[model samples]
Structure formats: C-alpha cells, structure tokens
Target: MAAIDEQIEQVERRFGVQLPEDYRLFLRSRTGMSQFVPPADDYLMLDSADELIDINEAGEFQERFPGSLVIGGDGARELLTYDFRQSPPPLVLLDTAASDWSAAIPQAPSLTVFLDQFPETGWIWGGDSR
Candidate 1:
C-alpha cells in the first residue's frame, strides 16, 4: 500500500486539485479495500486510490467534466464525483450518458461525513441484502 502522504501528493498532482482533509484522512486509514459493498445499492463499490486515478486518467469522464474527480461509480454508467470547483469539495453523482452535471446530486459536504453516515456495512441498517 502507498503511504498516505505519497497518495495525497499523487492524487493532487494527477487530478490538479487538493483533496479535502477528511477524504485524505479516510485514504490514510483505508488506502483501499476489495469487494466491499456500498450503502447505496445503485452505486458501485468504492475504489482504491490507484483504481480511481486510473478511471479518471482514462479520460472518459474527465473529457466531459474537466474538473470533476470520479471517486466511485455504479459499475455501469453513473459516477460519484468530487466537484473541485467547490470549497471543501462536495460529493456529486454524475450520469455519464446525458452528461447532465448541472443536476448533480449532493451526497455529502465532506468525505468524513460521507463515510460516517454511510459506513462499509451501513446497508445492514436498512436490512438490504448484500
């Protein structure tokens, strides 16, 4: 696993934007995990630092949303992103087909709150099958 500082630097350099403190801390604690389910059934699993960078660098989403950094996805067409233009970086869900970022749904104010509210196993609270 990459050191937290190294990961932070790599992310900022590649994405051309600074990561929020909470998200940085989250990466420090959990650099990456495999096969973990998300709270939302419609969304895909959260990706590791390397995987996320790869997804963004592929230029598929970046070409559409230039400043948006994709942090997660639904494994289909939708993506969960951090809008770098906003202070503290609010999480937004983007639909790839329509490229309708103007209707982006705000998921959380910061990564810390996002994780705290929707933990790895948070789906259990709603009795959703994993």
Candidate 2:
C-alpha cells in the first residue's frame, strides 16, 4: 500500500490533481494493471461491484451500458458483466487523486461503476484506463 501511495503521490505531483475517495480506494486496491482486460474468454472477478460481462464478446457490453463511468468488459468472460467484487476503474482513482489529472478526463458524479466505459480492445493512458 505504501508503494501505491508513493506512486499516487508521484502521479499527483506530476498531474497536480487530487484523486477522489472511491477512486483512491480503487487505486489502492489494484496499483498494477487491472485484471479485467485480457484473455478474451474467461470470467474473471473484476471488482467489488458485480461481475461485468466480457467486452471481448459480441461487443454487447458497451451496447447494454453506454456512457458509463466505470470500465469493465475484459478478462475471460464472453459477455459484458459488471463484477461487484473488484475495484473500480483506474480513471476513478485518478478522479480521486484530487489533482489536475481529474480535470484532464471524465468523472463519475456518484462513483457509479459501469462496464461499457472501458475499451474492449485498445489502450488509454498507457493502458491505465483499460
């Protein structure tokens, strides 16, 4: 956790933004690459929310849920599903950073985690948003 905090501090310094509470929690939970964007055919436990259908599938994950704040649609699942047992998106953490980074991107007013917001097969911010 200290390492994460250190990294967070570094990010804050670099971006001059303060992360939000929910976003901070999500970052602290998974300081590395999130476990939801890969393999394209397995149902992996995403976050503390609910199981999010795999976006790798027919791309229905984004269709069902659009303009969502959270990004959950990878892992090994076939369909997009929200996982309530995993952490939220890294963007959430950036939003919680209480720094300039938040100002540089979108945010969830209520921290309502969503699945479609995440890219099904791509990269964002060095894949941080993936």
Candidate 3:
C-alpha cells in the first residue's frame, strides 16, 4: 500500500527525524510488503507507516537503536533498518537481540539500491561494517 505525505509525516513526527528521501519515495510507492520471499529464502515483511510507529514505540527502538529506524524484519531474529548515525543513513541488517551497535551489518547504501537489487540479494548478514 502506498502512503500519503501526511502518513509519512506522521511517522517522522513519531520519531522526530526526517526519513531519507529514497525511503520516503519507497513508502510513497510501496509503503509496505508482506511475506515477500527473496532469493535468500527469508520472508521479508515491510512495515506500514502505522506499524512502524507501533513497532518502534513498542520496542523502545529509540533507546535501543539511537539514530536508527526499524523498517522491517525477518519473521525471526533479524531486522532491516536505516542507520541514521551518518549522512544518507545507510540501510543495515541487525540482530534483534544485539547488545551493542557495533553488531550492525551493512545491507545497502540506500533503500533504492536495496529494492533494485533485492531479488538479486536479500539482506546481507554476518559483517561488522556497522
């Protein structure tokens, strides 16, 4: 489902941070997806705008991830996130149970790249790139 500007703005207001332009564009077109089976064989479920707020707030993500936003996750222990600690806020894969930020693994430089190359390669794991 595509999200309107107001809905997107609501998400930003909830987090007190502007989402990356590329990600905003994604939400405009494909706000979320469910049970998207990629080549990695892991089921990917993207969160809708409302779900984003619910997930983040319910999980206390602000305290856990600091400058990052949880966009989606594998049904299990992994999460696809936008690490906002840097300019452009590169997307990353993180273990939900991670004890420190250093465990974040680089997944894509941007959401556009992630979608463009998603079928080719799903979430990347097992790296210490942060």
* Candidate 3 stretches greater than 4 Å from native: 1-3, 128-130
Q: Highest TM-score, which number?
A: 3
Give the C-alpha lDDT of model 2: 0.35
lDDT of 2 by residue, 78-120 (tens): 2222222224423322222222232223222223342343334
lDDT of 3 by residue, 1-130 (tens): 3347888889888777899887777777775887866565567878877677777775566788898789988777788888878887888887878866788888888878777777766667667342
Worst 10 residues of 3 by lDDT: 121-130
State which candidate, 1 or 3, has the greater lDDT: 3
- Candidate 1 lDDT by residue in tens digits, 1-92: 55668867888998899887777766777755434444443334566766667878764777777789888765666666898877767877
For candidate 1, the TM-score is 0.73
Clashing pairs in 1: none
**Once superposed on the true structure, which residue ranges of model 2 sit more than 4 Å away at CA?**
32-107, 110-112, 115-130
User: Candidate 2's error at 82, in angstroms?
Assistant: 20
Clashes of each: 0, 42, 0
Question: How far is 6's C-alpha from truth in model 2 (Å)?
Answer: 0.7
